[model samples]
Target: MLEELEDLFESSTIRPTFSYVHIILALYIFEKHPEGIGRYRLKENLLIGSGTARSLINKLSEIVDFIEVSGNNKRRGHVLTDKGLRFLKMLKKKIPLLEEGNTKALEEIIIQDKKLNAYICLVKNSADKLNSGIEQRDAAIKVNGSGATCLIFDGNDLKYPKSPNIQNNQVKIGYDLQKYFKLKATEHNTELDKDDVIIVGLGDTSERARLATLNSALTLIE
Candidate 1:
């Protein structure tokens, strides 16, 4: 029993590097907008700050040929190359599994407004279908399966309860969302965060799209 306890403690002690989340988000963003030119807009839409979003783009540029910046630096954006797509396809084969600590972190960052519980439900349900073979017909279906819910508060329609808030000096929540959904960064969009919250139907369309692409890519691998 002592040995088992030691092993458990050792396993729990392993902290994930920020690069893991960054790479995952980069892949997702690349997949959704292979063109890459509209990354700035994508960042805002996804509720990610300009700095964090740019860093992810820069890191991805190193690994794959898909990322390209505009010439003047006046208008910055990214475009995915064939190689990038292939890389994302490869990543699709390995589904990401979040530990209990990660889940707790997610809970803390998410705004616990009126829609908090619904968002949790959506996440839980959608996670169930992560490994399911069926193609998701729509965002609503996907959210239901993932056990997450959307909430419209302060005029911002948060697709999932997970906010892009920073915690424990970790990567932003948007980056984590990209990993959980297994898509490139620009795929998902964000509205405004508001106070008058209401539990809306599941509506993570972009996230669903990313998952679908990942699923399709995984199938091609085997």
Candidate 2:
């Protein structure tokens, strides 16, 4: 799945430093800001340089035609095409939940760096693919995140993949997850499955945190 997504950015005429994370983020940005966003604002939201942004926009338009220009000149911006909206819909079906989280509440029970921002996402039915969670952590780190913690919700409790001692803080973590995360999931009309997995991404900035969170969650998908 990861390699398939990465292929979308491939271009014979131009070499792009961007990855699938950037593409997913652009789709998300288009969805959130339907009013249209200029290149500068898009670059700011993506945290990428001018060249990378140009190349990325080109790929999004020329390669996949997911986005089209809106307005004109300085007012020019991008908006998701019907194809892009449908693609985003498919992505959301796989990853139903992705949002920023306040992990400070679980600091006492979960090991978290208070200085970093935290993002939480729920990937439906991906728990079976989770190992010791090292892969998720590595995925986050690849995107400049501090780290990621993967947890699976069985019928009863949320537990670490291979940590027997997880019961020590299992109750507390579950309570906090529901209080801070699950409520948001409910609002989206997406009920999390008992066997779904949750990933918490910790990063220096909010954008990095979100990007890392999605990247880690993607690993659990297939």
Candidate 3:
């Protein structure tokens, strides 16, 4: 993926030094862990000396709106956005898989109890809305609210379903969920042990739905 991205960068005709740095850092962290590379960790892994990862992060932040950094010290960490994930997917197709040691960094992020709670809230509504929108393509339905929803399906029981025709708005949300979860429509429906899966709903309003989902999921994790 990194090699492919390097090729893309080279082909783009932009010769900015920071552009290469940003792409390399983004791909490195992303390839290492699809969830994202936090700022401090990225700095450590990249062996970037002198200037903080913040500079590179700030640059990449302009192009990829989905990379998130948080912490009181401003050294917390970062994660990929749905947009960032799509970027990685594009590169993955072109690059031969590079073998590396099994550090399990990215896997740790998603599987962590606390982080999983965050992801449940962050991803659930988008995922539900996406699925609901797809369902609407087959049967008439209206997406009347901005809030997200959650549903559980048996992973093993879920058979691959056809992709439903989607409207422009629905398509964007659906694509985001698909990219975020790294799963296809059929795969999304597959069931897992309750202990192994957590789902949450992000509703339309920050006050009512989204926050509530976050709190609920956090409680579950706690």
The lDDT leader among the candidates is: 2
Model 2 superposed RMSD (Cα)? 2.8
Number of the predicted model whose TM-score against the real structure is largest: 2
> Which ranking of candidates, highest TM-score first?
2, 1, 3
lDDT of 3: 0.36
- lDDT of candidate 3 over 1-222, digit per residue (tens): 334333333325544343343454355365556444576666554444325456566655555464655332344456666666677666433221222211122232222232221213222212233333233222211212122223332232211122455434321123334333334222435323221222332223322222333323322221
| Whole-model lDDT per candidate | 0.36, 0.78, 0.36
Model 1, span 121-214: residue lDDT tens: 1111132223222332233343232322232222322333333462332222354543443221113232222321111222234333233223
Residue runs of model 3 more than 4 Å from their true location after superposition:
1-22, 34-36, 50-52, 70-75, 101-222
Candidate 3 all-Cα RMSD: 18.2
For residues 99-149, what per-residue lDDT tens digits would candidate 2 score against the true structure? 887767546434765888888888888877887789999999998898998
List candidate 2 stretches off by more than 4 Å: 1-7, 71-74, 108-110, 164-172
Looking at model 1, residue 119 earns an lDDT score of 22
